[model samples]
Target: HEALADIEDELAGLEAQAMAEQQRMALKQALSELPERTQEIFRLNRIEGMTHAEVARHLEISDSSVQKHLSKALAYV
Candidate 1:
């Protein structure tokens, strides 16, 4: 029974990993459909762990613009 439980846990972990990969692929496809600037902003904020303000500062754009781009990206994804 202990061994069976261990196998079940391992299978659950594999299923979770597969789901994560599928989500990643879907996100990538959605991002590809967005404009280049929007994609960059989204990546910087979401993937690079930058806040909206930080992304704005780094890109030399207004914070509002960064928020707008993120909103658009979020809507698509």
Candidate 2:
């Protein structure tokens, strides 16, 4: 029983690492396909973990425009 628990823990860790790598690749591929402004907004909101309002303020756009660009960028990704 102890051995089985240890194996399960190891499998869980491997699965988490694989998922992280896949997400990293996906974001990288997405960024490559995005335009400069779209990439900046996505990086700020998704990678940098900023709020939409914060990204809008920094980029000098409205929050709705931020949302629009993010939506388009995600669709491309």
Candidate 3:
């Protein structure tokens, strides 16, 4: 019974990892379909979890520009 429990835990972990990989792949594919600048903004905001203001600061753009890029990226995705 103890061995069975260990195997179950391992299987669960593997399943979670696989799901995360799938999500990453989907995001990558979506980003690849976008324009270069739009993709960069999307990656910074969505994948890296940066706020719009932070992305704007890093990209040296206005916050409104970040929001625009994000909106366009989402529409494309």
Candidate 4:
């Protein structure tokens, strides 16, 4: 019974992980559907760990523009 309980716990953990992965995939799909500039800014800020200022510097855009792009990208997702 103890072994069976351990297996059940592991299964529950696996199910949780699977659900989390599905959610991540869905989010990626939504992000992919964004506009090109929005996607680039989103990737730089969110996925590549860049700050808004850094993304603006790299993309040659203003910080406010970066923020707007991120906001629109988030809204679309």
Off by over 4 Å in 3: 47-50, 57-60
Top of the candidates by TM-score: 1
In candidate 4, which residue pairs clash? none
Task: Give one digit per residue, the lDDT tens place, for model 4 in 1-77.
Answer: 99999999999999999999999999899988888899999999999999999999999999999999999988887
Summarize candidate 1's per-residue lDDT along 31-72 as a digit string, tens digits.
Answer: 999999999999999999999989999999999999999999
Q: What is the lDDT of candidate 2?
A: 0.93
Best by lDDT: 1
TM-score of each candidate?
A: 0.93, 0.75, 0.76, 0.90
- Please list the C-alpha lDDT of all candidates, in the order they appear: 0.97, 0.93, 0.92, 0.94
Supply the TM-score for candidate 1.
0.93
Deviation in Å, model 3, residue 43 alpha carbon? 2.5
Q: How far off is residue 37 in model 3, in Å?
A: 0.9
**Runs with alpha carbons beyond 4 Å of true place in candidate 4:** none
lDDT of 2 by residue, 6-39 (tens): 9999999999999999998988987888889999
Give the lDDT of residue 61 in candidate 3: 100
